[model samples]
Target: DALYVGNALSYRAMAYMDLARMFEFKRTGVAYLDEEAANRGIYGLTVPIVTENTTERESRDNPRAPFYKMYRFIMDDLNLAEACLSDAHAVSAKTDASIGVVYGLKARLWLDMGSRFERYVDDLNTMISHEADEDLNDYDKIGITTANECFARAAEYARKAINEGYSPLSESQWFDPSIGFNTPNNSWLWANIISTNDIAATTGEWQSFVSFQCVEANWGIAVYQDEINYAHGWMIDARLFDKIDEGDWRKTTWIDPEDAGASNAFITKYSRGTNLSYNEWRNYRSYVGIKYHPANGERNTSTIGNAVSIPLMRIEEMFLIEAEATAHTSGVGAGKQLLESFMNTYRMSAGESYTCKAADMEAFTDELFKQKRVEFWGEGIVYWDYRRLELPIERGYPGSNHARQYRFNSYPEHVAPWTNFYIPDRERDLNKGVILNPDPSQAIPLWEGGN
Candidate 1:
């Protein structure tokens, strides 16, 4: 029973973590939506907090939880998980939650919570009255009242996970067609491993084809070669690609124009000997990703290609988190040192060292985030970071690689509110208390700049 309860709590904590990031207000001080949603009074509501203890009647009438309360529940779930779980629990695989995974989530949650500090305080005052369970509702016990405090906890937890002996992958292991991201390595803290019998395998639409360089699959970038079928293939923004230094090992993950030799060789090496013509391969954009190949370097449309492992958490992220949190709690210089150390050790090519050119905190944070974006490309991690930081999305510029229709800038201030998902209509219809987020969906203005 304790084992089941511990696992259930871990899952609940994970789900709540996602919900908090996905639904929390971008900025409580400022409305994320246009004036229309604020006028409609549905601007900043988050998802309803439905805990395991919430009764059916209560669930049907639950109000959207504020940022503080939502996080309170999430922390409580993790706390319960830590208590319920065995210290010696044997975690043979990266898929299962371990003490290190719990620490990783704590680090992530603290950093994310600290990202929207103004909103957290404002929402805390508004929702502080409504209470239920004493143990979970006592926000005072959480001990994080300010962004700096949250950052301290984030660094502390991240350090704990780092002490668990996991290290970042080396250059040779980073894009190894056989073992690179498609399989779990020492760096992975948690992952989702697809097996032959899994639906993702049976359906043959797993991330290996959708986002990875699995040319053997019928879909993804390979769809362009034959011209008979089409599926949306993911690509990197030219602007982001340009930021990657030539010496950085990650530069080879995508089709780099400057490294035409390596790029062409990769296309041929992983092409399953399809021998697509130059024009055929060039039919698609040049910056197509080639990072995630199938397990064991499998090159076919069979289930083997679909049975790829994807990391959900990695030691590399913890290093980033610790660096970021240290910047906030300590000084930018100290954090910059941590970042430079991490990059020099794990990211740079042999004999190359990294240095931070940022003179201040803002520039330093931006530099760190840029490094993270490049490090975790195609990993579905940067979007949440963008949301948390409210960083502008600038997909439109000269020579941009974004699809023509998607080439637009959401910049100079906050990330586009449209990036925040709207509460589902089905949920709204069923629960009277389920307040909705402002529908920020609309055709954005296209950039007039040439691509």
Candidate 2:
């Protein structure tokens, strides 16, 4: 019962954190507008907060909370979880909310809260800062005031997770047929396990089975066997692919652009019995990822192939957060040292040395972001980080391979306002006080800068 409650609280806190990131002011994507909104208290809304103490009637009338209140609510849940979580479970039990998971979550939360410290810090406007509860008063000690304090807390919590003895997966384990991403390992702090009996597996309709491109499952036959000309397989942007160094093992995660013919193993293996023409069986798609394959190296045509666990939190993420937080809290040199240490320990090959050439904090963070994108591709993590960093989506460059409809640049100055979700009509209907976000769903034109 104790473990269950702790796990529930941890998951709840994660959900709230997602809400805070997703629904914060759209204006914050731009620097000048962000400062203006922070000063005027305009567009600082996030999703509504609900707790066990709240009645259903109260929920029906609840308005979206201010961003600061939502941040506080998430922190409260994490604090409760930290107090309640058990250290009995080993890190290998990746589905459980172990102490490492709590610490990692704290690190992630503090890193995010630190990014926009001006808005997250409580002031006299709403005045929810001084609750009579002693636990609420403990916020200062937990590092919730200045940006430096928040980063320090992030680094501290991340180190706590690292000290739990969890290490990154080795290269041999990266695409191991026996262990292939489907099973939980010691490297993960938390994961969502999909059992053979689960509907996702039983139906063989999960995105990982059909959309991962390299898996020989479901609609995947269209790509591997050339049974049909389904051109909608997941692929990486050409610009991003070009940026990856050839020496980096991660660059091989995708199909090499030079190996477009029947020489590719996927086409040769599956096209043996098919009546595919010479050109039909060839893999024409560029930069499609092959990192995630069916379990046991078996074709995912069967139900068993669909049984895979998705990692929610990994030990490597804690390392990244720690390094980034340290860079901001201390200096670029300290942060760069940690980055190099991490690479040498986990990512580098024998006799290979890694160095950080970033001279300033911005350059250091840019390098860190690139490393993270390559490391965690197809894991649904880069999106949050990109949003947090206010990076422009530049897919409209020359020689780009992105789909025609999506090939547009979305700079912060122009505003990709649809990045923030609108409140659903059903939700607004249920909660009368809820205000819907402005719709920004129009098609964006390709940016023509420097053309």
Candidate 3:
């Protein structure tokens, strides 16, 4: 019970830190006093913490307070969990696994928060060190400063999880059509598995819910597919993909055909057969439908296949993060040396010769983004990268109106008109003090007329 509650609380805290990092601007550049003022003011003025049993009066008076409180509570709980895990042996089946997960979550949260606040750097460094020490056995035998170190850490945890008998189902297990589609597999680290009946009967198809198509079909969803796409695309800068020699496995796996309109082809890392509809039908819903029909199976029953485990954290990201962080602190050359080692391993895995020299800082950074994008295509970390880097959203790649439209016309701009529009009630309530809403005419145009 203690472990469960502790893990849950820690995960929640990590999520709150993630949100604060993404939504709020960094407090690092501000004056020390100003930073303190902002932190204290936000902490005080913000909503009080509340749980499921929060009173209605408390909620009504300070709606946002509970969220803030919950974040604080999460941090406290995570600290407690770390302490508890330290003394206890790994006698329980799930204790060690939960501890590792909590450590990873804390590391991610701290890393993100570090970008926003100066104090968070020390916190993040501490967390990373703790995780590194705890999960040392999982790491590949490599020097700490090398690019391989990051990959080694990522791979270590991932391998530990797998070796401990927690792994995602293989492609064959997920695609096999002989078993019932609902059969659960061991690969899912954590998931909310919904019923087939609930899924098929829903108006939105599975593909519509999970893929980039979700944005086009429904604007209501907060996360945009284009944002995700652009974020991932930006990571593949000239340094990484452009430098790869012809016939490299990463080039084939990481990059799609760079063509526009009908000629464009998507990278295959996240690509399943056709769309989700076809894949769903192939994997589940054995009945012959418009989208899919089993080669042989009863109605509504198809051979059970393995589901793709949405990798929350893999070995690859750790490598990139370590390399990037080291590059930022140490010289770019040191970082490149680390990156090259990983690249060599990657090439060796594909039976190819690895050859590349890390020379310029700009080139190294570019390569970092490229490798990250190719490695973590669909797992949803791209937006975080852009936010951390403070890069402006570039529309339509290097040159194009379509790209500009997509980039500049963000969620804030779209919602601003509605938020800051003139209010008739305000005008009526305070005649002499009527709020002067900015005119639409004065607003900067995000893009010129048409493509």
Best by TM-score: 1
Candidate 1 residue 366 Cα shift, in angstroms, is 0.6
Candidate 1 yields a Cα-based lDDT of: 0.71
Give the range where candidate 3 is weakest over 10 consecutive residues by summed lDDT.
284-293
Q: What is the C-alpha RMSD of each candidate to the true structure, in Å?
A: 3.7, 4.7, 11.8
Candidate 1's TM-score reads 0.88
Q: Please estimate how well model 3 matches the true structure, expressed as its whole-model Cα lDDT.
A: 0.39
Q: Looking at candidate 1, what is the lDDT of residue 303?
A: 70
1-451: candidate 2 lDDT, tens digit per residue: 7777888989998888888777665652445545654664547688888878879899899888876666667777788788887563464467778888889998988887676663434442333444333744633323344777778989999999989888898876775655556678878889988777878767745354534534334444435544454644567777677877655655656656776554565454323322234464355466766566555544635567667777898888988999999999889999999998988788876777788899998899888988898888878787778767777677777777776666667775333555766668898899987777655455456555432
Per-candidate TM-score against the hidden true structure: 0.88, 0.85, 0.52
Candidate 1 per-residue lDDT over residues 1-451, each given as its tens digit:
7766767778778887888678654532233355545664543456787765789998788778756567777888788777776472447877778878888888988888666663357644443444444645444345554678888999999998899888998877876756677888889988989888987777746344432455434454445535464432456777888887766767766666553334466454434322334454444446666666665666555576678888999899999999999998889999999998998888988877788899888899899999898888788889888887878888788887777777766655465666767778888777888767766665357787875
Mark the regions of model 2 whose C-alpha exceeds 4 Å error after superposition: 28-42, 89-92, 118-143, 204-214, 218-222, 262-284, 413-415, 447-451
Total clashes in model 2, counting residue pairs 3 or more apart in sequence or in different chains: 0
Model 1 misplaced stretches (Cα beyond 4 Å): 27-32, 40-44, 86-90, 118-140, 204-213, 216-224, 229-233, 260-284
Taking the candidates one at a time, how many backbone clashes does each contain?
0, 0, 23
lDDT of 3 by residue, 1-451 (tens): 7756565665555555554443332222224422553544432222234456666554544322222233345455566766555433233422223554555554454344333233234433433444434423332222233333343343344333334344433434433433212233443333233333444223344332222211112122211244433222122333334555664444433223242111223223222322223222222111111211122212222211112123344445555665665565567876777677766655333566654455776667667766666555445666666555543333333333244434343231122222122324443243432223223222333655444
